[model samples]
Target: MPTQDTVQRLYDSMDFQRAVQCYLWAIPIVGMESARQTLIDNAGARSGDLVLVTGYRDVSVMMGSNVTTPYVFAHFDLTDRPLVFEYPKGATAGSLIDWWDRPLTDVGAPAPDKGEGAVFVLVGPGQKVPDDLPAGARVLRSRTQRALLFTRGLDPDPEKVRAVFETAKIYPVGQTPDGGRTRLLRFKAEGRLTSMEHPHGFAYWQRLASALKGESVEDRDRFFAAMLQPLGLEFGKSFEPDARQRKILEKAAVVGEATAKAGAFRKRVPDMRYRDDSHWEYLIPQSYSNEQDVPGGTMFEERTAFFYEITGTSAAVLSKEPGSGSAYLAAYYDKTGAAFDGGKTYRLRVPSGVPAKLFWSVTLYETDTRGLIQNEQQIVDRTSRQDLKKNADGSIDIVMGPKAPEGLEQNWIPTRPGKSWFTYFRLFGPLEPYFERSWSLPDIEPQTS
Candidate 1:
């Protein structure tokens, strides 16, 4: 019964809803929580915003004023909401708990006559721990009530939730030592409160800096100008593809021209971070390169982890060979920088045989949060399993530095001015030592001054 325009709008709305739902489902697999936190950080949210953070067993809420300046928070019960304290005129909420060091007391709902009464305390955040708390030891305000709620499994108790809101206390767990436990309820003030965004909250300062300078709102166009922000997130130096990667993308301009549909494909993908030499793929590490290096493009899988090892003269060898169900490793070095008066050159010696059914590689990350080096032409200055160097004895010697070795120009990694450098190793099919306790990785030898 709707008009054509109205029907069109309804269909559009449905599409949007479906897209949002897809993104929500992809968060866990794609690590979207980290990105969501980053966005919330930029919005400049304040304390006392009813923060609600949860964990495996417990939930916590803190009064924002308790942690305003010098940033502190007041704790509270999970079942009962406490009253806000009257503040002085013209004064903002602040670390009131820190200033007063408020004494511990039963702040939840009151107990019934001839009922059991007890208290619970938590030592760590979100850990429902039952401790033999010292009597009269002065407990923190909300620690007891929050801990009790979980220890007694009262979280899902709708009756307790309803009772606490109305009468300020729920049924206690465990009986008191004497006769009948006098049911006591503690009332805490903090309910569902969120944390404050500050200098280091979530790249807020970065956004603010851009805004104050009248920069564009688009993230990619400001510092590193781009026509559009690359899909996904910028971690280290590379932009990792995100949920959009899973979304069915069409290349043709014609509407509904489904050239390619998303299919259920699964493979083991290694995390492109960290460098530990332990696995078999010593030939090369996973890395991104240019057209000259890898003209066939690159391959990646999902939900996979790789490993490697450093051995022999240096901690750069694999004790065991690799097996199936893994990826390949690659290594490459460029030696053009030695003529620039850069620092000394070093060599990596690997005597242990490379192992793995998939592949492996040893790559370079610029030291200090070693991110893949970003260059002008988009040619990643990294090596991989597809390319590498070999010594006369069939063993491998990797030359590293700002400048290339005399004859090992193809085996060089350029360094930033005077910054320290480290390496990352990737193994496609890391056998067993990754999870169990029996396997140990080789150490990385730093050429100490």
Candidate 2:
């Protein structure tokens, strides 16, 4: 017969293990929950409603976002009935992704409609498609109860971007566009509307519990769902953790975060390194599949690393051919392999002939929030589309530090002393050289002089 104390310790250990796994598995949904909760709470927007996050202040609040483009998106619930979404026929690119950060379909450039305007009939998991489908509408089958329609306006002119947004629409299948309760809801200013960082402590589990409410239990998730029961989380039931269970869950949350931070900041994977000579890493490899499905199983580690620091994924972002979608490279450290110190100064040299057919941009994000670095300057990015002075050959150097580097003010982005940061170098419409590795981007160097 086992002693009571020994049995209790064993049970506690098991519970902690399960809770840790829950945290890892729910990374994507937690990110999804943060975005959805923000729109509904801050903007008072509801399902099927399109909320446009425009301007620098608002767009900067989102994870892995840049102010160069206007973000147009909607959170749609298909539990009650099917919804119809219309993508405008203009300059834009992005995708409608499900809860797992899986793309339901590409919308703009790489989509079937190919920037030529398209209609979609979104059907929820196990929901029967109505017979009266629109003639030209494509059916989007979602495995989750809710889906997010995220896209970006790619025009250089602001008015043109607004025009593109005006043409977008979403409505329930049975309702006319006019009768639909959901419509475009644009806030003039982004007043700290949302923070994309996932909740912490017991709140993390709470958010996970809420996310699983309407979500159908997949075969893969059934085991994890069972594991959650002993730890006070279950579908169709309130998650009221007992004192011991709450302790275990709370402790697991801390460990989970540390584990995630370690894996993200310095991922151990071989392919994450963008180039052997550089410290820059690839955000998502060009070969990463939309669903992350591989030979034997899906790439959970890669998916976890991505959603832990960012949001949505799609085929358009994983551009295979040259001059198509986009390519993303990130740097968590400097040339000497040291984490970016906000207190220190650094410079990144953009060599001439960058292989982006459209444009390229460099932006900074706070290490913790993974959102734009908040500072006195308020500006978090510098791009080729802006007034960057390229060399006679199209090369430009960007400076980052606590203060503007004398004459380099126009090309400088302000950094805070105590807060560490990371950056992304994006090549939109990446060309053949980018794929062929003929063009190379160097690592950021700490400025000594």
Candidate 3:
């Protein structure tokens, strides 16, 4: 058997090929155990530190404002595994539909009057949302709806919440609560600052490094127990974030290593492509810049989709001309016109080459909520492979407005009055120019004045 130190050296030196082999064969059991150890060594969490855990719907809130939020959380009382129904904060604007109110709603509410900075407790699966509350009291139904609970007093802002999610120590409590025994605890500002430096990443890496040092298993457990405090600080009421779930996430991250061999791997890989770093800008680094990739652009090779950040500095890096061997992926608009007048006829001209092995399409959607273009036709129109009017020179023109041209009825995409709209272009198969940035799509120019 390899000593922990030996294993550490091997893990650090393994090449891409060797890494794949190790991931496939060795990491499942021992690898996981070491990872848990690493998490413990790093996270120096105390027993009483608060934590929060949520499901997909709650996760979506971090993605975008328009997407529907899920309601999945069990408020857990740490002392006793009692569950409590923490209602999604907000007012009953219309019917059963609810809006989330944070530090705002907590004010002047009943007993748990968290001024602004408060940490909400995670209820376990054994608990149920209590119904026998006062008239104004509400309940969070499922994990698929948008819900909000902060540490009872620390008016946790959106930014802090995001950071916690990105790197918080987590433990897996193999079993879900049998009855409704979950609970939530509200934490105040005093709790937030107690251990500000021990974020999730710090704890994870520290623990990982320690495991490689050949520490005893009991020491690893002790470290793990220490890490659990911060992980539990952001608690989930229903179930403890168990070990198996963490393994799933670890394997998922390494899945990217396969992209090291882009060419041969492409053929063998399922849905392979690249992911440009631009997408993570506003979402990650907290800044959004006009991503321009001319000759020197970075590329991320993913299994499903690909991304390229283009910078058109000299001589228009992307081509606007038609029939070019470029993948005209998509054309999006924030609004139909400068200011929607409702009755005026607006037109958008998209200049792109449809370079595809199978087919191509241009789809129009209302930007309001992305549900669809709510109009009399009730149809989300598109120009797909089956139909597209090619120019004599071999290019295509897509029309989006109220009415279609005299001869271009088939290519017309309807629009709603006073509403904003956007468009998307999809290429069926892979193209070389798209990956290399040799060809480019024409800009969507507004025609109507």
* TM-scores of the models, in the order given: 0.27, 0.96, 0.30
Please list the residue runs of candidate 3 whose C-alpha ends up more than 4 Å from where it truly belongs after superposition.
1-234, 238-330, 334-353
| Candidate 2 per-residue lDDT over residues 1-449, each given as its tens digit | 98999999999999899889888888988888888887786667889777777776677668888888788767888889998887789878889999888998998878888889898999999889878887798998999998897888887555677777677778888777776434667654535566768888888898888887788777767888899899998888887989998999999999988888887887876678766888887988544677877788777777778888887777878867888888899999999989999999999999977899888999999998898888877889998888876657767889989988887788999999999999999998899887777678988999887
Which model, 1 or 2, shows the larger lDDT? 2
What's the ranking of the predictions by lDDT, best on top? Answer: 2, 3, 1
Q: How well is each residue in 186-293 modelled by candidate 3, as lDDT tens digits?
A: 223222222111113223323223322322222213433333332221212222334533443244334522332222112232322223321101111111111211
* Deviation (Å) of 154 in candidate 1: 48
Sort the candidates on TM-score, descending order: 2, 3, 1
How much does candidate 1 score in TM-score?
0.27
**What TM-score does model 3 achieve against the real structure?**
0.30
Lowest lDDT sum, 10 consecutive residues, model 1, at: 307-316
Clashes of each: 65, 0, 80
CA shift at 195, candidate 2, in angstroms? 0.8
* Model 2 residue 197 lDDT score: 82
